[model samples]
Each structure stands twice: as C-alpha cells, then as structure tokens.
Target chain A: MKRNIRLLIEYDGGRYRGWQKQGKNADADTIQGRLEQVLSRMTGEDVQLIGSGRTDAGVHALGQVANFHTDCGMSCGEIRDYLTRYLPADIGILKVSDAGERFHSRLNAAEKTYCYRIAVPGVPHVFDRKYLWHFPEPLDMKKMEQAADFLTGRHDFKGFSSIKRTKKSTVRELYAIDIEKKEKEILISFTGNGFLHNMVRILTGTLVEIGCGRKQPEDVLTVLQTKDRQDAGMTAPPQGLFLVSVKY
Target chain B: MKRNIRLLIEYDGGRYRGWQKQGKNADADTIQGRLEQVLSRMTGEDVQLIGSGRTDAGVHALGQVANFHTDCGMSCGEIRDYLTRYLPADIGILKVSDAGERFHSRLNAAEKTYCYRIAVPGVPHVFDRKYLWHFPEPLDMKKMEQAADFLTGRHDFKGFSSIKRTKKSTVRELYAIDIEKKEKEILISFTGNGFLHNMVRILTGTLVEIGCGRKQPEDVLTVLQTKDRQDAGMTAPPQGLFLVSVKY
Candidate 1:
C-alpha cells in the first residue's frame, strides 16, 4: 500500500541552486534533489518529491509545501525524524502528515504569500545582509503604496515574468499587497493565487523604482497593459525574497 | 594636532577571531586589527584602537565602542565615510565623534548591556542559528529568573570569569537582569558597570543549567561564595552572545 505524504518545509536557500532537480547535475545542490536523496535512502526506494513552487537561488522558504508517495512501511513521525537527522542543518522538515490520494502540492495549493525586505536608510545591518536588500537611499512609502494599489487583483503578468515563451496562462490573481515599515526595515508581502517565473520580484522592482522616484505609480498600468517583459522594472535580487506560506 | 576620537562600531563576529588585536598576528582577522588597518591606510600612519571590552571569538556586537587618537587631517564625516568604504562588509562604523580629551573607552564608561539568545524547544530557526544558541530541551523560566535575582548587585564574580588568574578586580555591579521570552526563544539581557572575561557567558550557562533543573536557584550564591571556576556551570558558546550597547 502506498501513502501520499505532505510535508511543511523550511530552508535557508543561500547554498541551493534552486528548488528543482536539474538534469546535468543529477546530484546538484538543490532543495528537491536533497529531499529526494534523503527520502530514497530512508525508504530504500526512489522517491519523487514534488514542491509547491520553485524558489530561485538565494531565496528562502518558511512554509514550502511538498508531497511524495511512498510504499515503505514507515510512520510519518519516523520518516520525519529520519529526514531531520540526515538532512543538512539549513533544511528542516517542520511537519509531516498523510495527504489525500489525489492531493498534489502544486495543483492543490490555494494561495501563496511572499515577503521581500528592504533595509531602510541607516547604518548597514551586517548580519541581516544575507536576507535583506540594503538600499541606502530613503524610499517614499507613499509612492510605493500607491504603486502597490495598482498591482492588486487579476492581471496578465506576462510583462513581469522572466520566461520569454510559455504555454501556461500568464494571468494571476493578486489578492493583496501589504507594505509595512518596521524600525529600520521595510517588509512588502504579496498574497496571490500563483506567481509567474519572476513576477513577484519584478513587481517589487517596479514598486521600488516608484518609491525612489525613478518611475511613477501610474507606470504599473502601462506595464500590465503592454504585456511586454521589457516594459517592467528590473527584477529584484533573490536573497531578499521569502516564500512566507502556502495555503491549501 | 592630535585629536581624541570615539567610534561606535558593529560587526558580525562569526569570521573574525575576536575583538582584540593579537600580538603575533599583528594583521590578524580581528575587529580591532581590521579597524586599525583601515585607519592606518587612511591616515598614512599607524593606529591603535582601544575597545570598551574584549569579545570572545564568534561573539557579535551592535554598539561596541572604541576610542583612539589620530593626527589625521580628515574631518569626522570624511573619516566615517572612509572607514565605511574600506572596512569589510561584516564590520561597520556606525558613528564617529570627537571625544573629550580625557575620554577613554574602557575607563570613563558608565554602563554596558549584553544580550544572549537561546532557542527553546521547537522547530529550529535555521537563519538565526549563526546568532542564537539552539537548546532543544525545555527550560523553566521561573527557575532562570530566580537564579538571575542572585546575580544582581555587586559581587565577586570570580567563579564566572574564565581567566584562572587576574590582576583586575573581580567585583562588579550588575544593575539589571532582564529575561524575556519571545515565542520559542529566550533573551537574557544584563546591564552592568563592567563584566569580567567570559562573565556574561558563564552567567548565561549557570542560568540555563538552573532552568534545565541541573542546578538550583541557591546554587548561584554557593558559586559566588566558593569563587571557584568549577563551581559554576559550563561557559556557553560565544556565538549566542552580543555586546548590545556601551554608554559613556
């Protein structure tokens, strides 16, 4: 008998190539590759670990969901413990549970929340550099918030994606864009049904440009209407972006 | 004309040896050594930096103060900018100010505050591992608080000092001990006029031991009375400690 297992995962992705397994480097340092290796070793069989989404190199995850089917006679607790013991310290299996037979990590996902951090204008935070984008210049929160207003709701985000050609639909529903200013940092969180290859980063870049006065808030409308990738702002670096959670 | 200067410094101490400049390795990868190197190059003369206190290897700092005398012609703002540009990313000069002629970093100091972070029993925070001590065992806050009470006020902390022999006075005034629990993490903060070598780490270790039930609250008084190093608990790892601030 096979069991469909779902896992809530957390990882510091500084060393990972990405979330997916690559063909050339079958043993490449990747989140999925590492998970598959640990699972295969524990179960004595090959395991295909499917993730909710692909996070780019240097992108961290807090509640990344993954699913796998295994015929091995091991309890969820045992498998969780084995993975915890063998996996690298940067990666952790936060929770493990039985999933529905038809459940798929990506397909069954309802929404995802991602947060990007910006260091405010002040002394550099050396310790937080690995996880934050340090912008020395003061950013206008009003302009950034105005730009964020234009980013909410359904839209064809082809201009924001990195992929040049794709068969999948470019339309995605952005439920909310919350911009918060902490003591010396700014956190921008986005909740959406799904994101394009680099949609969230591009959106952040656009907002940042507006905040810095290089681009106006109304420019977001033009980028969305054109559906041309070049029309969008530069993609923000991956380090500052974090997959906050995935709702099912 | 030579001018007295004070520097507010911050550093991520994971890579550096410590805050002091080693005699053998004059160009050591230490915080003080690095600052002197940058200052020497900028001023075209040798520089000596005296810190408020020495932090052990792997110990971090947010506001570790230092003072020096320089005959350089550069303005304070220019010197601050030069240090910011030349110093390694891990080290930063938060502020540079002209100090009183008699101002000494270690002598005219008023008080200092240090914070130690302990990860409680829960899911590991992978990103914070570099700055927090991960203790998976459950700790009793009440026991730790009771132990901290005995640590306040002036006492001869000979048992807490790592140095076997010292010419300096072991008696120091501890103004306050603030223990805060945030989620699954415990933050232990100490405000004092001065601390002996490894004093904060040893105090934290003693409190942690008491929290885990290995020692009792009254054990603190016994340790102080004995003035024996072995009477105290283990010296906690340096990474979990931070020199939060120094007041003059």
Candidate 2:
C-alpha cells in the first residue's frame, strides 16, 4: 500500500547547486539528492521525493513542502525521527504528516510566500552572510514601498520573470507585495497563488533600483504593461530570496 | 613615517587554519595574510597587521580590529573606498580611521566579548549551517544558567584552555558570563580581559552538558578547582563561537 506523506523541509541552499539533481560535480550536491539519500537508507528502498517547487541555487526555504509515497508502515513521528537522524546537517524535516490520497504537494497548494532580504551595510554580516544580499549604500524605504504597491495585484508578470523557456504559462496572480524594514535589514515579501521563473527576484531587483533612486515607482507599472522580459530590472542574487511558506 | 590606520578585517577561517598564522599553515591565507596583501598593494611596502586575537579554523569574525603602518597619505574615507573596491567579496572593510601612532588594537583593548550561538534542532539551518552548531535536543536553560554562574569570576581556567602548548600565563580574569535564550537559539556571551585558548567553547560545552542533565552545576566548580584539562567538559565545536567585539 502506498502511503502519502507530507514533509516540511528547511534547507541551507549555499552548499547545493539548487533543489534539482544535476550532473555530478563533487560540489554539485542538491537538496533533493540529500533527501533521497536519507530516505533510501532509512527504508532500504530507493525513494524519490517530490517538492512543491524548485528553488534556485543559493536560495533558502524555511517552510518548503514536499511529499513522497512509501510503504514503510511507520507513523508520522517515526518517519520524522528517521529522517532527522539520517539527513545531512543542512537539510531538516520540521514536520511530517499523512497527506490525502490524491493530494500533491505542488498542484494542491493554495498559496506561497517568498521573502527577499537585503543587508544595508555593504559589509557582509559575519553571521548572516549566507542569508542576505549586502548593499553598503543606504536605501530609501519610502521609494521601495511606493514601487512595491504597484506589484500588489494579479497581473501578467512576463516582464518580471526570467526569459527561460518553459511549458507553464507565465501568468501569475500576485495576492500581495509588502516591504518591511528592521534595523539594517529590508525584507520584501510576496504572497501569491504561484510565481513564474525568477519572478520574485526580478521584481526585487526592480524595486531595489527604485529604492536607490535609479528608477521611478511608475516604472513598475510600465514594466508590467510591456509584458517583455527586457523591460524588467536585473535579477537579484539568489542568496537573498527565501520560500517562507506554502498554504494548503 | 608611521601612519596609524584602523582596519576592519573580514576573513573566512576555513581556508587557513586560524587567525594567528602558526605551524605548517602559518604562511597560508589567513585573515592577516589577506589584509596584508591588500595593505601591501596599497602602500608598496611589507605590512604587518596585528589582529584582536587568534580565532581557530572555521571560526569567523565580524568586527575584527587590526592596525597597519601605511605611508599612503590618503584620508580614512579614501582608504576605505580603495579597499572596498579591491578586497574579495568574502572580506570587506566596514570602516577605516586614522588612529594615534601609539594605538594598538590588541594592547589598548579593555574588554573582549565573545558570543557562542547554538541552533537546537537536528537539521542545520541552510543559511547558518556554516556558522552555527546544530544540537537536536531541547536544552534546559535553568541548568545551563546555573552551570554558567559558577564560571563568572576570576579563576584558574587552565582546565578550559586547549591542551596545546602556550607561552602566555594561564591565569585570566572573567568579568561576566551570561547565557541568553531567543526563540530556539541559545547565545552564551563571555566578557573578560582575555580568554585562554578554546576557553569560551569549553565553557559552553560544560554548560551544554549541564543543560542536557548529564552533569550538575556544581561539577563546573569542581572542574575549575581541579585545574585539569581532562576534568572539564567536552570542547564545543568552533562554529558556534564568534569574536563579537574588542573594546578599546
């Protein structure tokens, strides 16, 4: 009997190329490969786990959801314990629960939230270096908030996505976009039904340009209206972005 | 002419063994080595940079203070700008200032503060994996605090020092020792005139053992009294320790 299990995963992406398994480089470790290794060893069978989405290289996730099918006859706690013991230090299983028979981690998700963090001091924090994008120059928060307001509603986000070829439609419904500042850290959060390839990073880059006064807040609406990838700002670095949560 | 220059040094201790260049890896890429490289390039002379202290391999520092003799007639802002543009991304100059010729970063220091941060949970934080020690089990704050109190005073901390040989005298004054809890993180801070080799880590390990209920608070005082390396608790990992500040 195949049992469905839902997993809440937290990973440090700096050590891995990304979430997907790519060609082997001694350094090409991925989150998926690490998960499969621990699961396979625990169950004594090859288990392929599927994630809700593929996070880019150097991008972190605090509440990433993944699911896998197994016949180990273990309770959720047992599975959690097994994975916690065997998984590498960078990948953690925060929670494990039984999923509905037909539930899929990716397709069944109702919403997702992502946050991009920036450290204002050009000098990197010795502690938070791996988790933030460091820009030494002081940023204008009021300008960033103004630009973020233009990104709040549903729109054709083709201009804000990477120019990668994909089968999935480029249309994404952004529910809300908010910019919050705390001390020297600036957090840009996006809540949406889904995100296109590089959508959050590109949007962040555009807003950063606005915060630095290189671009105007109205430029965001123009970029959206153009529906051309070239109209958007450069893609922000991967280290700053984090998948915060997935709503079922 | 001796020009007193205050340098903000950043280094990845993973490449070189530690902050103080000694033994076989003495000439390796240390924080001092990297700082010297940039300083020499800027001034066209051999520059010897003195750090606040030596941090072991895999240890990191954010506000490490160092001073170098420079003949360049550049202002502090100019030197900061030049270093920011030339230094590698891993290292940065937070600020530079002209100091009095008699000033020495190591000698004029009044108090040195260190923070030992532990992440409790089996899975390492992807972002902080390189910087924090991941402990799976829940820790008892009461027990840890009780054990820490025993370490707050002038005492012979020979038991906490590294077994490796040292020319410096073993007696050091510990002004304050505090253990704080924030969310799932535990931060143990040590403020003193000086620290013995590996003193903070060994002290933290003893407290951790007490928190786990493996040892009693009174055991710490006993270990201190014994003045025997073997009598102390296990040495905590280096990743959890940081040189928080050097007061001048």
Candidate 3:
C-alpha cells in the first residue's frame, strides 16, 4: 500500500545548492536530491519528495517540512532512524509521520518564518562563521525597527525578489517583523504568508542599510511603490538566513 | 624597543595540526604557526608565541591565552587589528595587551576551564555538528554526576594522558567538575590547576562511558590508581572539546 510520509527536517545549508534539485549539479548536491537518493535507496524504488519552499543556497532550516510517497511497509520510526543513520551530518530528520494521501507540503502551507543573524562589532565565535553575517560597528536599532514596521503588511514585493520572469503575483502578506538584539548579535525575524526568491535576504539587506544610516526608514515605502529591484538595498548573503518554521 | 605582549585567542581548530607549531608542516598550518607568521610579517621580526598549553588538533578555544615578545612599537589595538586582518577566519585575536616582561601565559596561569559538548538522543541542529559530539542515546546523568564527583580534587591523572613517555609528574589538582544539561546538549566542565596531554579528552571519554553504563562511578578511582592508559576508556575526539577559559 502506498502511503504519504511527512518529514520535519533540519539542515546546515552551507554545502548544498539550495532546496530544489536543479542546474547541472542538481542530482548530487541539493537537499531534495539528497533526500530522494536516501529514500530511493531505503525503499528500493524512486521517490519524489516535495518541499514546502525553496531555501536559497547557504540558507539553514530548523523546521522545513517535506512530503514523499512510498510503497514501502516500513514504520515511520524505522524510516526516521534509517535516514538519520545514513544521511550526512549536516542534514537531519527531526520528525516523521504518516500523512493523508493527498497532502501537499507546499500548497497546504499557511505561513512561514525566516530569521537572519547579524554578528555586530566583530565575529567573536569562530565556529559560527557559517551561520552569521558579521556586520561591524553598532547599528541604529530605532531606525531598523521603524523600517521593519513599514514592511509588515500586504504589498507587492517585486523589488525584493530576484525573479523577473514569473507570471505569479509579487504580492505577499507579511504578518510580523521582529527585531531582537542579544549581546553582539541581532536577529531579524519575519513571518509572512509566503516569500519570493531572495525576498527575505533583500529585505534584510534593506533593513541593515537603514540601521547603518545608509537609508532612511521612509525610503522603504518608495522602494515598494516603484516595484524596481534596482532601487532596493543590495542582497544580503545567504549564510545568515534560516527558515525558522513553516505553518500548515 | 622590545615589549612583552599577551593575547587572548579564539580559534576553530578543526583544520590545524594543534596549538604548537611542530614537524615539517610547521609554518604552513597550526594555530601557533599561523599566529607567528602573521606577527612576523606585521612586525618584520621573527616571533615566538607561547600558549597557555598545547591543545590537540581539532580542539577549539574561546579564551586560550598566549604571550609573545616583539620589538615593534605598534599600539596594542593596532596590532590586534593587523592580526585580525591577516589571520584566517578560523583563528582570531580577541584581545591584546602589554604584559610584564617576565609574565608567561602558562607559568602564571592559576587555573583553566575546559568544556565538552555532547549532543544526545536526537540531533536537532545540524550547524552544531562541528562543535558537538553526537551520542544518539540517553545518558544516565546521575551516574555521570557521581563519576564527576569522584574526579574532583587532587588526583594523579597519568591514566588519562595519551603521552607514552614523560618524566613530569601527573599529579594534578582538579578544582571542580561540573556537569550541566542544556536541552539536548550536555556540557561537561572541568576546572583544574593543569591538565596532561589529552587529559581532558580522555577524562570526558571515561565519564561518558560511565554515563552510558559501560563503567561504574567507582571505577574512576581504580583507573587513577592503576596509572595505565589502557585501563581507561577510549580518548574522546577533539572536536567536542573547548578550552573555555584560562586564568592568569
């Protein structure tokens, strides 16, 4: 009997080429490609795994949800163990369960959260270089907070995404934007109905520029209104970004 | 004019040979070697860096102190910046200061603290793989605590050292052994007057064995008395070990 299996995954995406299996190196390097390979080996059949979203290269995830169809009779617990034992150390299966036959991870998702970590003043932790964006000197928290406020609503985010050919609407509803500073690190978190390609990173870059006094908080409104990617701040690097959670 | 300098160093030792620069690979890799190279180039003089002690390859440090003598007149802050700019991302100079001409990082140190991180049961964060030992099972905390209590105070730790030939006394005074669990990670902390070669790693391995029911709490005393390396548990890998602090 074929069954739909859902997996809650965690990964340090520094080594992968992102979530989707694309490009010439897709089959060997991407997260989905790796999962499919492991699942195919485990079940002795080809498996198609669908991710809720595509996280860019060097983006980490703590609660990425994926679903796959398999005819194998192995228990969910066994499958989780097998994946944990065989998968690379940078990827892990946090939870496994049986899903309804028609459950789609991407289509059923309601919201998503992404967090970006900034190491200010200096990089104090050598082990965290893969996970933090080191931004030297202090930032103007008030200005960044003010800029974040301007971004928390339904709007056309074409200026934020990198994709230009998509026929889909650029509108996305941002539920929340929380900026928290702890010690030398600042964590900017975003909750939204969905994100477009490079949207979160571009948003982070723009906010950081505001924090650094390169741009005023009100400039965000103009950037959004123009719907031009060139008018926005530079795209931030991917190492600091994390898919915090997915709501379905 | 020659000046005495003290440096507070932080390094992700995953790629280096060790703290001390030795063998034919010296000057190419190794924390000490890298630091010396940078200092030599900055000051235009050959430099010798004396660390608090030698750490094994792959052992990380947050506060490993070192001292060196230089003839350069650069300010401490400038020297710190020079080293920071020249050294690789994995090795960093956290603080630099003028020291007494006679001061030595190893000789003047009163105590040192080391920490070992163990990931238990489920691996939730893949980013922490390089800094944590993944032990995929429940550990008996009570047993580990009891074993740690036995290890506190003065004890001849010859059995714990990996050195096969050494005339130095292995009698070391351990100030405390603290075992704390933070979510899925268990931290094993040790404060001691000094430690022998591979002492901290060996001690951790034996404690973990006791925690997993492979050895009893009372066995620590017997291992110390025997003064035989073979009687103790396997030496734990260095990736999970950290030189947390060194007191002057």
Cα lDDT computed for each candidate against the true fold: 0.90, 0.81, 0.90
Considering lDDT, where higher is better, how would the candidates rank from best to worst? Answer: 3, 1, 2
Pairs with backbone N, CA or C atoms under 3 Å apart (clashes), candidate 1:
none
Indicate which candidate wins on TM-score: 3
lDDT of 2 at A113: 98
Tens digits of per-residue lDDT for model 3, B1-248: 57999999999999988898985457757899999888989989989989999999899999999999988999999998888777888998899999999999989999999999999765565878888887766889999899889889999999989878788888999999999988879999999999999999999999999989898999998888998998888788999999999997
Q: Candidate 3's error at A139, in angstroms?
A: 3.7
lDDT of 2 by residue, B59-166 (tens): 777678989877888898888877867766667677799889988988888889889888866544555666677766678998888777788888888888885666
Please provide, for model 1 over B6-123, each residue's C-alpha lDDT reduced to its tens digit, 9 standing for 90 to 100.
9999999999889998874666578999999889899888888889999998999999999999888889899988988788879988899999889999988889999999986545
For model 1, what is the alpha-carbon lDDT of residue B239? 89
In Å, residue A16's CA in model 2 sits off its true spot by: 3.5
Stretches > 4 Å off in candidate 2: A20-29, A44-48, A119-121, A133-147, A162-169, A181-185, A208-223, B8-12, B23-28, B121-124, B135-144, B163-168, B209-219
lDDT of 2 by residue, A1-248 (tens): 68888999988787678887774443238898788777877877778788989999888899999998888788888888888777776787889999888889898889999999998764545457668887656779898888888888878888898766666677778888888888758998999999988889999998888888888999989888998878777799999999999998
Which residue pairs collide in model 3, if any? none
Question: Which should have the higher lDDT, number 2 or number 3?
Answer: 3
Name the weakest run of 10 consecutive residues (lDDT summed) in model 3 chain B. B120-129
Give the better candidate number (2 or 3) by DockQ. 3
How does chain B of model 2 score on TM-score? 0.92
